[model samples]
Structure formats: structure tokens, C-alpha cells
Target: MADPLSPFRSSLLPVGVRELAPHANPVTAILMGRGGSLRLHLHGARVEGDMLLIRPGVVHGVVLPTRGADIIYLNGLDFPSDAPLAEALEGKLAQLAGGALEGGRDAVDELRACLAASASATLPSVADVVRAIYDDPMRRMPQGELALRLGLERTKALRCFKAVTGQGFREFKLWSAVQYAAAQMKEGALVRTAAMDAGFADTAHLSRVFRRVFGLTPSAAIAGLSVN
Candidate 1:
């Protein structure tokens, strides 16, 4: 059987309307309201729009509409310029919201195509780190150990990761684990089982991290969630 979590790298999920507190995103995300404009809360400012593009590590919040929202997550190292990327994704998401697109998976595939078209070349070392984390998020690899494996000083490795991915290595690892846990839950795993599978200490630990990063408890977010 195919791995159900394979599509998580660049996937789409449909979520019900809910307000999210300010939190840092671990990957690039595009959010579109289903029936109306969603409100975005930024630093000392707020904006209302039908769609919003959030880059990795950006701290932001959202007030979704009554009809809920469609969120697309892109977990790639190459990201195009924000304006053009947002414009293209907005059109695709609009089609999805209007039922013109076949489904969330199809929409995600189209979005990935768009991303690929504009993706720039990535450094090998950076790609290596990304691959390692995604390949086994449960592994407890310390920063120093990773740096040694990469044949660089610990501080340089940290800088390289932050510069390439726009987030610290530890932050990326935690986020990857969280995403893995979410995928497990989508496959009908219990929270406790998923937490352990994702390297979380326990259910409470997973809950706290989930709420901190996503502004929703695991149970709440996993209910009726569709993972591509």
C-alpha cells in the first residue's frame, strides 16, 4: 500500500471557520475563505481579504469566515516572490472554493505545479538537512550532532539553516514532528499513539505544542479534517 502521509509535503486541508491566535508558521501557507473574506491580524495592523499568503516563520493570526477555509501548505525550499505566487494561488483556490476544481488534492497538485515552475535552485547542504528531518522526524538528532554530520561548526550549521529555510533548525524539526503527528491522526491513529510516533513526550506535550503552533487542540483540529 502507498504511504498515506506522502502527500503531506505539499498538501491541502479544509478547515472550519475559527479564529487563530498569533503563531509562527513552519512552512509556506495559502489560506482562502470559502464564502467570504477572512481577517488577518499582523503586527499592529489588520487586513481583510479573500485569500492570504503566509511565509515560513512569520508570526500572524487569522479570523476565518463562517463558511470556513481551505489551507494549502507548501513544504519546499524554493519559494517564488510573494505577489506573483499569491496571485496564482488565489485564482486556483477560488476555483476550488467555487467547486470548479475537482477536489482538494487536485487543487494541491496544481499549486505544486505553480511552485515548481518558479522554484529556484537549492543548495545541496540545505536540501540534505530538510530531507533528513522530513525523512524521520521522530529521530532525536541534536543540533551539534547534525552539524557534525554535515561537517560544519554548530553555529554555522544553525546559521545556514536559518538563512536557507527562514527558521531555526530546532523549530523546523519540531514543526516536522507536529506535521507527522497530524498525518498519523489523519490515518485514524489515537492522539497518544500519534504523539509517540511523532517523538512527542506524551499526549499533553503534543496538545500544548499543537495549540501553541496552530491555535487549536489536536482533537479540535483533527475532527472532520481532510488530509491530502
Candidate 2:
């Protein structure tokens, strides 16, 4: 199957976190409840709910107990409105929260479907650039290098990239790197290993960026995992 999250999918991680310190993701993040509620702290906007559509670079933290959740990431899309996408997936997530174990996977799959159904066609030039970056998300991506690769003037490339992804080249690179590293942590990789794999200068560097973007130390986020 074609990856439903091509070009614009940021990170799709499992949720139901006991607690997450304040953090920000570079892309839009949709946290949907599987079968429980969460008390969220989104940069001082406290709300408890089954779903939230966080815009790009938004700072938010959540506490999940008992019920599982799926965190969906979006690079960018032309949704008519975020409401329908959130509403449709909210039902699927609520099902999972209602003890529909089978629905857990279903919810995620359907969430992708829901997003894909509403995804706007990305412009070819922008798609080429974004897809390249995503293909090697952990690679050091300088704006000038990206411009050369895309065969466009540095200034034009910068403008075009921002126009499509709504993020500057450097900003997207940092987000992509952090996003990749966080996924590795979920799989039981040590902070150091994840940091190295994600192209950080070192664990301390990764920790700093991780703490800033996630509002919690990398150690804290990895605490929930058992290395297998």
C-alpha cells in the first residue's frame, strides 16, 4: 500500500502517556483518545478532551491514563476545515476508548484514510523538495544544499518551500530530526543512540532540543519504555 502519509506526514506515535512535560512538534499533531480522557496543558490553554488538532510548532503537553491514544502527524494539508477530519477520527478514537481493542489499529488506519481523503494535492516542485527531506529525515539538511538539489535559486527555493510546508528549511530540518529521534526512543533505543541516529551533535545536544521541543527531558520520555 502506498504510504498514506507521504510528503506531509510528520510522525505517528502511540499515545496514552501517563504524563508528558511541555513540548512542541514542528508539524500539526492530532492526539485522539482511544478510550480515555486527558488533561492537556497547551501553553496555558487547559482542556480535557478526546481529540485536539494542534497547529504546527504549537506547544502542548498531555496526561493520559488507562486509555490508549494515537498521535498522528501531518506535514501540511489543505483541509476545507480541521473540524471534519477531527470529528471523523474522533469517532474512531472514541470506539477504541470504549474497549474496542480491534478498533485501536482500525482507528489509526482510518485516521490516515480520513486525512488522505482530505489532503490537498501538493505542488510538484514543493513535493519534490519535501519528499527528499522526508526520505532522509535525519540527514543534515542545509537550506543552500536543498536549493542546489532542487535546482532553484536559494531565495526562490526558500520561498517555495515555505509556501508549501509553511516552515522554513532549517525549521523543517530540526523538526524532522527530532521527530525521527523520538520514534526511535519509542522502540527502546537509548537517548544517546537515538540522538546519534537522528544526527544530533550529541546526547546533551539532543536532550536540550528534545526538552525544548517536548517540554520534558529525553530521559523522561524514554522512561516509559522497556528496551527489548
Candidate 3:
């Protein structure tokens, strides 16, 4: 699928029967095991089911068979709440259950439809700012500079950002950067390089935040092997 949004990215991971450390994302993540099932610990809550929807920053620990399972990363969409969005996601799950990767591609249309349905009512107040961050998370200008660019006061900008994303701008920036770095690691980037590129102070910093947010170290996630 051609993602015109440019910022949003999605991919299917390798297939296997495996378990990895519990991890959280800075962006929306759709996780489903084979047969559209999963054993999950979400935000310290135990949930086992056919599918699980994780919002940005929600901690999730997954346990799979000795082999491993596949993962699909869905980014650039807000957490779905309204019926249309929910139904669309459920539809995608149905596609997965049917044993078709087509669902992953089809998800783009569903996401757009849901986005429209949600926007038909009222969109987030800071839609433009949010889009900028969503587009290039690493390029977030300083609050003062961003405020000037948006032609708003810094305080107003902060409030708008928080109201729309339910995250402090600084925190959101960090999460976005860290997730990008993690993605680099998944793609085989060295820890040092990923840290530098993702705007982290150092590998140790990435390791600390990564462990705190995802409940596992970077290497552990890469190996897809963890004890708990």
C-alpha cells in the first residue's frame, strides 16, 4: 500500500514461535499472534486473546511458544475509540484470522476510513503540530521555536500538544525518538548509532528508557528470548 501520510510506517516481522521481552511503543502498535491470538500483559494487566490493540506508551509483555511469532507494527494513527475505527480494526483482525497478510495492506484503507469517521465530529485541536511530530518525530524544534513557528505562545502550544496527545511535549518527543532508535536496532543498527541517530545521550540512556518502557533490554528484544 502507498502510504501518502509518509510518516506512518508498518511492517510484518519474521514468523516463529518465540517470546520476547515486554515492550511498549511510542506510536500505535497492533500485535497479533498466529491465528490472530496473543498472550499479553498490558500495563500490568493480564490479557490473553486473539488480538490486542496497544496505544502509544502502553507497556505490553508477551509470551509465545518456544519457537516465536510474527509482529506487525502499525504507526501514525491515534488510539481508536469510536465505533467505526474499532470496527475497522476488528475487520483487520478478522482478515488475520483468515490467514491472509492482505489484512496488513488493507489496514491502510480501514485506517483512513476510521480517521475520516473520527474527524467528521471534531479533530484534535493541535492537528497540525501533531502531524508534524508524527511525520518526523526526530525533528521536533524546541518549544520556543515550535511555538514561534506555529504563531502561538509557548504555554498555549504546550497545552494544545498535551490536550491532543495526552502526553507532555517533551515526553512525547523522547518516546518518539526512542521508538525510532529501537526500530533501527530491529533493522540491525548498532546500539551506539541508533542512540545517536534517535537523539539519545548514549547507549546506556537508551537501555535505561527502553527497559523501563518495554520491560526488556534492547538485546533481549533483538534475540526474541527472555525468561520473564
On TM-score, the leading prediction is 1
Model 2, span 1-228: residue lDDT tens: 224544665456664346777777666556666566666675455766766655555466777765545666656633324442222235644453332222354454455455454445567767777777767866866778768766889999888788777788888777788888988888888889999888899999999987777656777666544311
* C-alpha TM-score for every candidate: 0.75, 0.74, 0.68
Off by over 4 Å in 2: 1-5, 15-17, 33-35, 42-44, 66-69, 78-89, 92-119, 226-228
Q: For residues 39-85, what per-residue lDDT tens digits would candidate 1 score against the true structure?
A: 77777667667876665565777888776777666765345555422
**Candidate 2 to truth, TM:** 0.74
How many backbone clashes are present in model 2?
8
CA lDDT of each prediction against the hidden true structure: 0.68, 0.64, 0.58
Scored by lDDT, model 3 comes in at 0.58
Better of 1 and 3 by TM-score: 1
Query: Candidate 2, 211: how far from true, in Å?
Result: 2.3
Superposition error at 12 for model 1 (Å): 3.4
Clashing pairs in 1: none
